[model samples]
Target: MPTTDTTTTDALAQVVAQRFTDTPLRVGTRTSPMALWQAGHVADLLAKRVPGLRTELVGIETTADNWPGDLAELGGKGLFTKEIDRGLMAGQVDVAVHCMKDVPGDVPLPPGTAFGAYLTRDDVHDVALFPAASPIRRLEDLPQGAKVATSSVRRRAQLHQYRPDLRIERIRGNVNSRLRKLDEGTDGFEAMILARAGLGRIGEAGQRPYQLLPMEHQGKKVAVLPAVGSGVIGLQARTADAPVMALLDELSDPDTAACVTAERVMLHMLLGHCNSPIAGHCVRTPDGREFHLRGMVFNRDGSRFVHAAAWHKDPATAGSLVAADLLRQGARDLINATKN
Candidate 1:
């Protein structure tokens, strides 16, 4: 937790709680179970803080909602966010909730909109899940030439670097859908790689065999670090949308936001789009003013890579500059190659 004087911002929540004692708040989220789950979490938080403040969940369709297929082809993270952003700008929704990872570093949140609060982060590691019958218990424990499934090019590329002998395959749908592929046996994936945050959020963290892979960022292991914006949930509203902002300010986690902002700055500097095989994570000191970052980029074939790090007293600029350094040293080359 961040110290009060350094990064905490609860003033907004206090004002909103005082003002909206008699009105209901309308929040917007996607129709997916996970999206609804996030909205419910926000509603619960607001309900506890503001007595008798009614909250309603407004379901909106996104690119992912209408077209659920190979996310890689349709674009991965952004597909879930664009529609909700459109809704927010159109005044159809008061607040938009999102997985911070899915919100790009270069977010164009209309002119008057901003992300008010971010939830406390969860576990930020990659997990490898195997069939209940499989003997594999870790990344290194897999047999030679084992098949692994993942929809992320970043995961596939990294897997090749560490487990070149294993075959990487693409699997789609939500977490449960991908898990079913292994049980059904048609996918033939011996194991699958998924974000630890998602699993922890949904309470399935212990069901899988997780080997914390070392992500190349500075010199430390990756388990303690997190990808840009990993594990945090963002709540956005117009800057002038005082009611929504107040509710968000009350629920916002400053430590998580500062860390995520720094991480995202790195992503933005590297021009790391959703399609790229790049990952980064940021962490803040207990005081909440100092920040450290680790950024990684891999070749599409996963044969080559680069890792870099930097520190900042102010997260906003420090994170982006660290990422810029990585980009200058062949990160851009890898991204350009993917385009070609």
Candidate 2:
């Protein structure tokens, strides 16, 4: 028998190991412009962190595709995630990227799949956009009975709290469509609410002198709290998937994960589902040594609700404490009643 070349075999082994280390990963995400942008952003980050890394975005149209009705009418759970989850379990995709806010709390993931990691968070505040020609810069500036477009229970409830007189109209479509509608006076809307992070990611706002623009498109923050998990990108992978899970861990942001954890905990504790009008936000100190969490729940009409706040060195459990406080304040009653 011919003797094997030990040096050659060793060199080949090293090459194989390096290839495994720099393996290309396929990412699953919605086909929408913002979702594609997010997946591409993740791929860029992975390329920087893992030498020779590559990725392709696998567009998955979720159950919510072309959904024109309000979430309340549709039960509001898994509309954006059911199909993506199936892709991972079927080995069609290595991982799935989700809008943290769009992920539902009441539904647990299928067995053997889990939350892998979260990316760096963006702004967690809601933004108000209005026709620049109009004087409505904020919710308070709306004229009595002025129409505003939104499908979020959280926004509707908060708006009711601030301006009960304003009419909350249901609106749907992509970011560009919504802005165009607002400019075209669709549903006679004077203003609309959108997430600041979404607008910033797409650079949707224009730079013209205020009056000439169809919509002001300013990323002006509002007083209302954000939906739990907003501005955070939720990564999902099969629990049994060591290779993909490892890659996800490499790209994860621990600080943002901690904050979102606290907020999600509150969401879980409240049993929040779609159209529940629940909101939570958490923040870590600059040193990253401590976490502060705030949670709120309101009836759909904003007739009643409860708010709670807490802090801890460990961000994960801080949300639980805040939720407990809110429960003691009768948050469950408000949420349950709203659901009914």
Candidate 3:
């Protein structure tokens, strides 16, 4: 990693000017603490890699920031991404860091914008946070009609398939709030499903008294298949934004990029969104060129499911191709059951 020389005003000025050249670069992110941390992490990595480069972090608020309403009714995943997109298009920010899962299946990036450069992913499994009875360890142990809270339609739809007898309930707010709901028993939620990575990030994973039942997606266990871009962080820049794009390239992880590319492509092809129980996972083979993907869709009630797997040449568009194949094989009907 490169370090900047900040010894003197003139030296710093010269260093900054030389590093940035004539064009300044800015990165935009959501206003949430996690978003800011993500932005700062990117900024530090970029600055360290490109000595003297002056990068500004801009915090922009989006619908998810202002409204506490249901995420499902938002219709698109853009609620979390559009603000940054606008910042890029308006020249307010040159690049943006995004949690890829929040990006919709079909994003109309402005003509000049492009996505590349991803950080390594984190744990993608969903953990169950329960309060009493340590012996009630896994999903099977939860009594019938046990109330499980989650906001994701995806989780709700899938959980129903496994334990239809278990009561599913809605939960809003961030990880901490949901955990508090369970611990305090004020929210009537016995347990809440949350991504283990999110909990670990906040340093609350160990404090929870409940056991984590690893989540599975598309027939692949969470430990085996990470949600598309689950631990990866993405940087997007305008195609014309050479300086920022080059900086991002310096921070890009080859393996992470390859996997997310395949995953996002699969998602884009399937038109899967936050509301869909559709899930996908992609992994790179040891040789680093080949990729494998698993995709699945569950009936609205989670009583039925379709699974597909595919292998692809270095790129791994096979995931999307597999999803398309599944859709051709009654996935549409199973998914449509949600509307009924």
All candidates in order of lDDT, best leading: 2, 1, 3
Q: List the residue pairs that clash in candidate 3.
A: 112-239, 121-231, 122-231, 161-302
TM-score of each: 0.87, 0.86, 0.84
Best by lDDT: 2
Question: Where is model 2 more than 4 Å wrong at Cα?
Answer: 1-24, 132-135, 205-222
**Number of clashes found in candidate 2:** 0
Instruction: Compare candidates 2 and 3 on lDDT and give the better one.
Output: 2
Alpha-carbon local distance difference test for all models: 0.74, 0.77, 0.71
Greater TM-score among 2 and 3 belongs to 2
How do the residues 1-340 of candidate 1 rate in per-residue lDDT, one tens digit apiece? 3334322334544566555556557688988666788898988887766655678889988887677566556765687888888788888777889888777654455677899998888777777788767777676777899998887777888777666888988776767666777767787888888888777656667765566655443333323234567778888887887767766776778777888888876777776766777777778866766787778888887888777888788887778777778877888888867653
lDDT of 3 by residue, 1-340 (tens): 2233445434444544574687655879987666777888888877666566778899998876666677667755678888888888898887888988777776666677888577777766677778653356566677778998877667776677667788888776666666767777886766777777777766787865645555453342222233566766788988775655655665677766777777777777766656667767777777766788777777666677787888887555676678788888878787666533
Off by over 4 Å in 3: 1-25, 132-137, 215-226, 287-289
lDDT of 2 at 21: 61
